[model samples]
Target: MDAGGEEAKQERHLVLAHKLFLLSHPDLDDLAKVALRSDALDAVKSDGMAPLFESLAAAGVLEPDDALLAEMRARIDEEVRKLDEKIADAEENLGESEVREAHLAKSLYFMRVGEKEKALEQLKVTEGKTVAVGQKMDLVFYTLQIGLFYMDFDLISKSIDKAKNLFEEGGDWERKNRLKVYEGLYFMATRNFKKAASLFLDSISTFTTYELFPYDTFVFYTVITSIITLDRVSLKQKVVDAPEILAVIGKVPHLSEFLNSLYNCQYKSFFVAFSGMTEQIKLDRYLQPHFRYYMREVRTVVYSQFLESYKSVTMEAMAAAFGVTVDFIDQELSRFIAAGKLHCKIDKVAGVLETNRPDARNAFYQATIKQGDFLLNRIQKLSRVIDL
Candidate 1:
């Protein structure tokens, strides 16, 4: 990345962090206003975020400042003029690479100023001049950053596909690893935890995408997604014992205990860690919408793990094992059982829970049957096309 690209990446993260802070601290209006004016406005101004500025003003998050807006416009115009001059000179007298560099500089400028449509247009122009697979991938990465910053799923999805296609043409290992983080974040934001978990775990040791987030945040996502997606055995091996995760997991509050307690079957401690993790989840823009779903999934995992141990157990004993009251356990079990999330029956009269656990063979058979059905449908479609 060039200086402009690096600055653009940093500014993108800073702006996103500020917006996320405002989202999570709605009650602290005065503080938000101060932070916006003091810390964010300069960057916003440089980025020429007129719509964002007006939106904040309309929302009363910031007072309207005509002078700042004027200054922002003036600065943008001046910088764009210089870029055009450079591009024109390069086209007139310079070689192909110089012209390509000039065009890329202009594209990066548009990206830095948060001009999404212009940035994409200019990037396409730059891509037209680029021949190397690596350079094309870099362009895709820039597009991905813009998509992520704006939370534009369509753009993000398309960019990710484009990056993968370019990688097929040939890309370096570092860029490939970086793409995994980008794809993981997209999957996570789109509520596909299984795919996200796979991608995050793959990139854990090779995580160099600091522009997206820090190592701690990466580990946090890895742990959170793995807990819901990975089996206990895999979780123990990949997350609980992984050196990359072990190194930074403790830095994120409640996260270490959250992963370890569940793996260790310490239900009470797990619950405490889980409770602490929820506040952070609620504060996150991507995770907040899925909070209820995540809560249900985590509960299902823990409940299923507990029930896997025995054929039958007293309700009181199960409750005590989780450090909860008998009534609480009974209610929780009844809800999960009714929802078909847990394969157990509660014997209210005897205060015993009987597990109806499926055998491994049976589960595999069911999975095979479903897959066979899917394959048959696809084959029938192919036969029809052949007949036609």
Candidate 2:
């Protein structure tokens, strides 16, 4: 073969090798090296491999050397500028390749700087384009990624539905797992802890079985949802006792402390630990929505435990112990009492909350009445059946 042909063949081999390595390996350092080498060999101005480099840079896999990163960014910007010119010049049909590359460049840059809305806006440019199957899939994934990064649950749901329609036969396992993760996140955002926990556990199983890199995230969410839902046994079984989860939990001290306090039933300690990490928790996009509700649920558990331990406690003492105003305690207790969640009576004049246990006689009478109602309903159903 001619020298030019041989060099082209070599470039193709390198790009293919790099893509294969990314598919199999989860090591960022190794992937960075492959991406750099591939970019060096394919030294074209508007290289198609820009997306691959963009992915690595966004993931922080590239070297932290500022000079190198700056150069990379400059080149990407130049390429995108050229693509914009080409798009503007085309009258009828914008070339698919040029449009996709421009979209990817702008979206990646916006995402790197945490401008999720701009990233999403860039993605929308290609929404109505006539693209190949692979590009269509990329658009779907990018839409979902931007939606998730910004905690846009509505957009996330729409993207998932679009993905389902685009790949109706269920696509690959990786895509299915990604959809499951988003579904779980939606449930988490909506405060449906039980359903969220179940979906996260399923995603964790899929990730573990596939040896995926992001199973840790699913594990963390599973534990968080389980805790809020008061399913400590499941949390222990699915997270605390699992070796994989244990390994990852050590990396997040806040989570570890929260779990420890929960397991030990140190309600005050748990709140203290959580309060200390409030700023950090608020910064997490996925966890922010659940913060206020989870705190309220934890407080409920603490109050219920306190009530169980005392026949009658002064509202002032309870408020002081919980570090809240007496009025606040009164309001919360009133809510619980009205909802029938707490079997207690508040004596406003005495400023005491008196615990009430079900009397055996009253319980027996209620059970008898319930059984009679059930029998009457069954007889009515049988009478209707006979007439039919």
Candidate 3:
């Protein structure tokens, strides 16, 4: 065999071994291209070439000797499509959670595709215990495909909830980042810039901290789209100035579209800042002070912000966000209303206080309540002054 044909044979050999990438990974294409090269294939031993061979086979670029490997991939892909169709049918016929069959089939496919470890952690162990082997979220191997479909269809809200449930049920950071990207997507869709920023920051922090690959760029795409969507100059400026945020944007081809709307060329100061303070300034600035503060303080700060924001918040948004039966939120809200800590009478609900002072007892709770109870736990403590 000539050199090129020999290299192609080697690639096919690797593919037959089930060690190749089954699909193109947009995130690691640069690193991945090296593995796809004939030179790279020639450098590796037979065992070491497995992943590369798998990629070549999946790409259909390998030699044709590995009919068995091609057959296996075809079978796996067929089962994946069947499971996807089953999921769609289950959703149409039955109600929620009826698609466990599809999850199981996809789970097996994922396992066969060399994503078994990723599948194992994502498999719903508790649910799997109740159901037999062939169906469960944990058993679903085609999650990544489903996830991408959800993203493509712009069903961000439903997608986020489903992915999050999967994550909380013990899906690893790989799945979590998928949900995080969706969360950012939700904010982007709703035009809620700040929430998008927070979601993106959280995604970057978690993905970087975990050292996971391929997904880091995905979440950043969500953030970039969000920034461009934002009408506010501050939002655009903040993200563009941030280098961790900028690198992903720089990598993507969509930068030119934003230039007319965002004049990013003028920001030389941000560019200088990017080179200088990047290590200290993370993708976001919000989390640093808290990590410096006591852990308990973070929850308190969040709750305080929530309560402050709650005063002017309408029952509608609160109900949707907390995902409660509406009556529950409304009922509890009445209690907060009665206590005077929350004033619901304002004509506006889009904005509210960011914090509350705990020192002044009379600012709220003018209404009399029975003393010696937890009625005003959030109410400011009273100060006593006696002339001696």
Candidate 4:
């Protein structure tokens, strides 16, 4: 790899290190220690990110070293001095573009050093000197990365809006596609799976946002968000049959089985895949927060799909289908039924589940009756107001 590629890889590993620290998995503890001690530490020292180093040290993710901290601070001061000189020289003897570049360099330096506030401030200064919409959008992308690194949703939200506004002033297709992935990530983190799924699907074929994550990670996010939000037909069309997903779905462990088994109506296989991948789900920084919710949604999807094919089914048969005990199936169905997630009623005495899915025509008719009653009440209140 070239110098740039090596630097990018190191930076990516640093981000991964941050994510690893956020995870609570015992299996990843040693891996986290290695990353912090090696690649992550090297990048932090090279960028003179004393703040990040100190934070990691305080969190006990890294060992505290006073001498190394002092050295990093000295390096940061020297680099800032040189950057300030470059800015002054450009302002005194060079053109507007040179001054802008100098300011941008300083901003990028602050970003590398993990100084979020300083980087944002310097970026605003650089943005003041920037003229092209595309260049301005690039600056927003930088801000978005900082937001993502820190998991600051407020900053991420503002940066996304800023990017969209810059696009309205005219932006390229590549940046636009990149922004979709960024926005998709934001929505996913915020638990808006429907919007996240839409944005992810839109960017599946056009994804080039490696700065956010690798292509495989992107595919994983796309599949995860799609399964819960999309109908069966849409899931089959967009994810199961799509060439982009098919090419890389197997790369992620148990993901292909989880997706395919659910779609194929293989209850036992789907259950196994789901159980096998819970660790993967729990390990993800973004998905970890919604892990339990996701588990419930997956069960809901599978149970609803299974019930759709039968008017009534024995609890023993259902338990056998899922490769679970009958008591477990009964309890699962009872909870889902009580919560209104499943459109079925369990008959414990008869040891059978009866599907009572609401009739679409009857539902619409009842909705119309409710609306008519509301309209009549509104007219009567209006008449009383007029009389008064």
Give the candidate number with the greatest lDDT: 4
Measured against the true structure, the TM-scores of the candidates, in listed sequence, are 0.87, 0.56, 0.32, 0.90
Q: Candidate 1, residues 1-388: lDDT per residue as tens digits? A: 1334543555364455546455446544675557656666665665687656677667765679888767776777899899999999999999999999999999998887767799899999999999999999989988988887778899999999989888888899999999999999999999999999999999988988878866787789999999999998899899999998888788789999999999899999999999999988876767877989999999999999988998999998888888889999989888988999999998899999999977999989999999999999999999999999
Residue 126 in candidate 1, Cα distance off native in Å: 0.8
lDDT tens per residue, model 3, 103-136: 5555554544544344444345324433432233
Off by over 4 Å in 1: 1-11, 14-18, 24-38, 46-48, 362-388
Best by TM-score: 4
Q: In order, what lDDT does every prediction score? A: 0.85, 0.63, 0.43, 0.87
- Candidate 2, which segments miss by more than 4 Å at Cα? 1-81, 84-138, 149-151, 165-168, 205-220, 305-341, 346-388
Q: Residues 90-124, candidate 2, lDDT per residue (tens digit)?
A: 53365666666655666665554444566677777
**Candidate 2 local lDDT, residue 73:** 62
Ranking by TM-score: 4, 1, 2, 3
- Model 3's TM-score against the true structure: 0.32
What digit string (tens of lDDT, one per residue) describes model 4 on residues 1-388? 1324433643463365455454435656676656546766676777778998898889876679999999988888999999999999999999999999999999998998888899999999999999999899999989988888888999999999989988888989999999999999999989999999999999988987777777777888999889998999999999999998998888788999999999999999998899888988887878878998998998898899999999999999999999999999988888999999999888889999999999899999999999999999999999999999
Of the pair 1 and 4, which is ahead by lDDT? 4
Q: What is the lDDT for 137 in model 3?
A: 31
Ordered from best to worst lDDT, the candidate numbers read: 4, 1, 2, 3
